[model samples]
Target chain A: MLEWTRGQAVGEIDTPALILDIAAAERNIRAMADRLIHGSVRLRPHVKTHKCPLLAHKQMAAGAIGVTAAKLGEAEVMIRAGIPEVLVSTPIVGRTKIDRLLALSRHAIVLTVVDDVGAARAISDAATRVGQKIPVLVDVDVGQRRTGVLPGEPALALARQVATMPGLVLVGLQGYEGHLQHVQSRDEREAHWRASMEKLTDTADLIRGAGFPLDIVSTGGTGTSTFALEAPGITEIQPGSYVVMDDHYGTVQGVGFEQALFVLTTVVSRTRTTDVIVDAGMKALSSDSGPPRVRGIEGAQYVFAGDEHGRIEFADQGSNLRVGDRVLLVPSHCDTTINLHDHYHVIEDDRLVEVWPISARGRIR
Target chain B: MLEWTRGQAVGEIDTPALILDIAAAERNIRAMADRLIHGSVRLRPHVKTHKCPLLAHKQMAAGAIGVTAAKLGEAEVMIRAGIPEVLVSTPIVGRTKIDRLLALSRHAIVLTVVDDVGAARAISDAATRVGQKIPVLVDVDVGQRRTGVLPGEPALALARQVATMPGLVLVGLQGYEGHLQHVQSRDEREAHWRASMEKLTDTADLIRGAGFPLDIVSTGGTGTSTFALEAPGITEIQPGSYVVMDDHYGTVQGVGFEQALFVLTTVVSRTRTTDVIVDAGMKALSSDSGPPRVRGIEGAQYVFAGDEHGRIEFADQGSNLRVGDRVLLVPSHCDTTINLHDHYHVIEDDRLVEVWPISARGRIR
Candidate 1:
């Protein structure tokens, strides 16, 4: 089925290329924006998902209050691209990162999180050195055991410390219910978020009781957007995956996001008895989470990832596939997959439309 | 630790920067060449690991016979830099990649592998269209179910087809014992290589017995370098990881490669209750293989990973780290870790020497 233009076929493009859908991206963007508008929570999109300034601008244009970055380099690129409001969601450690964060504050409304008193001291010292007071959010570790201080008095103490610090302004509390973001069952996810939000809200109360005004209380992902918005004292939600849903997030029940992003690969080789091999594999689609599902192919199982080849097995009639045939693969995880490519080929109606660079694709620093 | 002086001190340098030891690199390059010279196999280091033309040139200067590439784009970059010989080790399929491979035949001693007859025919046709007779090697599948055809008649038949096709030169067999490359035990790896190389040698024998000239019998890796050199038929060894040994490869017994690469991250904060958090995590160092070993720090464990922070725990000291401390992390896997960065900050001890661009860092295409 040659539905696309001849030259627009995947066989015509080079291997390991990232293919994006502008229409689908626009749809996903609008969907997230519409949800926030109908809900009570303000949206501060996490730009760490798609580290492109262009994508950040698109999110800002679609009614997002600010963009959140996982790295300072990412925030720098966003600020350079004229994005005035950005949040460095990840903790800023090291003098180099703190310096960058300090510099970023001069350019935009940059916000960072602190979980420990020492980290708060570091941020305060950096701000004092730069002669600029930076807004600090107490990161409460609700369920995601990765970072953030434990909820309750511990988080409240950090928030109080920030308020007293000379050059640091204790603005709010930021907690991410990351563990609930990928839970398949919506009820289970919501139940988990409700419990987590209770702790964050309790922490917020303690911080407020400590004579500090908490302006922003951000928590939740695309999976628990509605629950977080309905929760008491929560003012914002930072959801990243809703804009470009992967196989993992797309399967979340009751989530409006569709599996819009896919890696377009061509069937390069085939064996008579075994299966067909596509040009996309571990490098094209990350396997850190799990194996990708071949989109729309009946009873076909994808397995055996080489550096560049993906072996696909059909339940019946393996002979039906041949060289030059295009296949769409649903990536296991969207964030890591997007980081693998230099640019995204924006396709619309099976035709070449535009190309957007993953401008901050490899901005590790 | 302040040795080299390219610019700033290691403490002053930014977090999550790739640090390469230039002196160690030169020694590693010569070490691979020396090992190959003392053995029977010719060294054709895979440039896919480093993706730097300067490093490729250094490999050849250190007596590597040729360079191997994982993609045509890398081969093109290397060829443009005047590296005369190259082998696109992966199968060249899809019209665009085939066309690029065909075009590569004009300027360099281009060689590629073919596991399927259909791919061989396509490559031959593309080469014939460009009026160039490109050399082809039968990629024999030896243990790693990733790519290549099975040894014996399946491979011999493909070799026969390649010989029959116009504009194609059927070279010998190419089989990589990739599974052996990471076998923790040297004895176990050698045994596996001995078994796999026997099958590949027999396959090479079948082709040569059929009156075909088998010149290049390429195989092996840094883990199985010595084993492959001693193989009866493996004329060349492709060892890419030896140039910059990773923590994973460094643990291999009798493999003299040093831990020359590290992710220079700085601690931004410290706590009396917990280990310091550094500004480098999965985004800086890949966790695909496992957590990176903290070089020279005994009883130290790399705990919880965020997108941009690696929490380090030293069991005995119970928080010996302080703010602004520089931590050098030995990556678990070098190949994937290098792919995470844009440039390599070549350092001798603690000072920056030169920043080498990972030119083909994301050259999956």
Candidate 2:
């Protein structure tokens, strides 16, 4: 998997390469930091989007309190990268993950979210066996009924159990408004975002009112971060995709972040006059959200050609696409797209600056 | 990244693991070999599906003539693993990929398909510079307008040019009917399959009549292997996914291969009485073609919960799913799903077996 080295031109780099614009990404990170500087909420950017320790370090340097990880393997990578604070946002079950989480706690300040008593007890037992006190947050289901308990009583009950559990400290609550992230309208998104935050704060208050220490109230993502900062009790925000905005997030109104990530591909084959094929397909740019949007190619559409190739269809018959021509595509989803590659070709202007290994990539365990 | 070691129970393996049923996959390899043994077309199974050299060796031991790769990186991995013959089915453009392809030709009997003159000239120039005569195939567009020239005079012209070009040998023609691979009805699929072959053979005859020696007429996939074996001029079939069946290809009517690949996951969180959340989501099981199908769990449907979780909705409220229960899911698309993992946990009768590294998993250049 040897790709282009530093000082090579962008066009000279290999096809289907994950290219990150350093300037645009720095601007995105700086803008998010500026937005939350005066607010009560702190930034704890999720590492699952870039999965790069270098980028996570940039986020931490830009005023993030910590980083959020979706898996224990990712947290291990971040902790090995010398990140001091990391919160595993997803619940861990089974002895395998719990053991690994306990091992990770030896090196870093690790916190995990849990929605069930069985998982919480498992973590508590593992932490006790390792002679460590692990922090835990009660994951509350705000709108996305994926992995969380109910907001009010169910969350408070779990928090109470976690607070009393040996070798475990009850931190706060995590109520992610995942469904409200892509609501498509500012008014609708704000209305649902406010309601979701109110539910989270109410649960936080219920847990605090039950004479338990609730130090951290974490929530929000790239879509709901602005509204979540204005909410009453959200102590930190976890916006992952804002650093490398995708085509799906680019459509969200009021997000001033520029698209910073692209899959640089070459026109490999031209079948018809208007239909040119590129070297990137489902393996390069994920089609989970939708097909990636072609950057700066007017009246051109990117379609899935195969698992290893993509078709760029032009509306005009007089298209000038030829073999060896390079094109840029904004991925539909940044998280999954980043998971498919091994390294990122960090570019400044037209030159490759660095090739950072996606340290947490394929760390699904 | 320390997953379950060999000799562990299936339930004890880590969550979100790629599980390969050894017995079922062997049977699938044998079935495809049996179909091609007595026919005019020989089996040249594509390695892009499993991306494992061990599996490619199994296919070769089961009477496959060679292997087909979708990229030069995959061919390099296979050749390094001692697979003697490999045909890169996709066109290789740009200097970086062509240089790699030429380097691979020195180690094995390497071949690649070309649809345009520019790609052919580049391959020819690189092969000449490396002092190697690389085998080339004229990729004819049967129905997939993704990467191929037309199957008439255009293919003959490209074949002639490749034959006369320095350090390049025009060995055959490849016409893959990729669009006809997934037609629902058998009659409709066979109808289009026969037409695609007719076009392929017609192009082969045209190329031969134009004084070019056409040695191989290769085509077909897992969906159209049976029809392609019976096609008049198709001397070899390139079926990749039959060895490790997926949900999308399993729905194809007559492909009798058993589902061999599964994402082994554990129940991490359960929100509702019928809604059980597993540790596999978009990053575990690819949702590109569609959501994965749960194996053996009656009346249960898997839906995308988040990046790290999947919601299993049971039609009946009497669900027995709980935390730490393992479930196996057949991926919608095996190629992209395999790209997300680093190793395959091979299993035999619920006992742990060999853990094969997916050597070419991320070899997408």
Q: Give me the candidate number with maximum DockQ.
A: 2
Question: Which ten-residue region of model 2 chain A has the weakest summed lDDT?
Answer: A224-233
Q: Mind giving the per-residue lDDT tens digits that candidate 1 earns over B91-114? A: 787776777777677788989888
For this target, which candidate reaches the highest TM-score against the unseen true structure? 2
Q: Alpha-carbon error at B139 in model 1, in Å?
A: 1.5
How displaced is residue B104 in candidate 2, in Å?
1.0
lDDT of 2 by residue, A7-71 (tens): 99988898889999989999999999999999888999999999999899999999999999998
- Report the CA-based lDDT of candidate 2 relative to the real structure: 0.89
Candidate 2 colliding pairs? none
Off by over 4 Å in 2: none
